[model samples]
Target: MSNRLLAIVEVSPEARIACQANGCGHAVYKRIHVVSINGSLQVLGSECFKRLFGGAIGGNPAYSSSDGRRLTDAERRMLQENTAQLVAQLEAEHEAAQDPAREKLQRISQSGIAREASGGPPHRFRAPLPVRQPAAPRRHLGPTPEAIRKYEAQAKIDVRAKFDVDPNLPGWRGLVLQRITELSKSDEVPD
Candidate 1:
């Protein structure tokens, strides 16, 4: 029962849950994930849970709402709808770029949502991924003729690699060069 989750409850719809993970305790909302291990329950805040456990919210059926019943189809649809609403809310809030609901749906779409058992729960609330800081923009080097040539040569090499050019084949170099020349223009090639 030390590291397991026997039960979890939502004390308040608008309140945060205190994380029970080792050493670091913090209040978290938005995505509360609970797990039962070794017959014990732990209420891990979103951050602690993500740092300790790398998995995101799943559609495991073992998890039930406070009412003890699994998610109804309507409830699942509502959750999806809420995600869409969150999108609109984000735009209104001027936070659409960092919308948690959008990120959650992206992750679900990529990894897919799973249920606990064949006949278990339909869907459960999942914690969203931690907010990511945007990466620094790459510096744009002006389109110098050297840069253009370099790009064109790289493209030709890529074409060669993709086709597995056999140097032994008759007219292989001619064919490759012809393709490259056909793709290039006087403006791109420069003087």
Candidate 2:
């Protein structure tokens, strides 16, 4: 009979995570994980057995996929699907092993809001409510629809007097020079 303890070893989806206390197999993908079967973790996949025991597994009785050609598309797809399933299974098992109550509580919390929490309408925004006024006679200097929409939505309320539109207003040159001076003298900035 196979080692009962060895049967429970399982591999994660990326093949890097191993379920069970004894993390075995060379790569994470090859880590044998235990899956419950018939109320016992004694289901050992043949591929994993071959990898672990090699020719000694069956003493060269049956055929070997090791001596086969490249894997077909079907095989590849199956591998991907199996990996995903195994990973999910092993992760669930791991969570059960490590603070199972926390995991269960997390699942319950993610099951959507309770009916008691739905007392009122969902909160939402009602900004710049589209109240299109009647259009006036054509004005040549009017902003393009796209430009007007863009600006309307994100109209810069540049309260900073630095960028004020007045032509004679002082610029940010003083601010820039002060920043440069502070940067040069301060060790606050890292290279």
Model 1, C-alpha of 114: deviation from truth (Å): 36
TM-score for each of the candidates = 0.26, 0.18
TM-score of predicted model 1?
Answer: 0.26
For each candidate, what is the lDDT? 0.50, 0.40
Query: In candidate 1, which residue ranges exceed 4 Å CA deviation?
Result: 1-14, 56-61, 65-191
Candidate 2 lDDT, 1-191, residue by residue in tens: 34322222323444343322234333433323333323344223445554555544333211122222222344334434454444344455555667878878776665434422676544434687689999897966644565444433222222134455432236644454454344444523332
Q: Which ten residues in a row have the lowest lDDT in candidate 2?
A: 60-69
Tell how far residue 68 is off in model 1, in angstroms.
Answer: 13
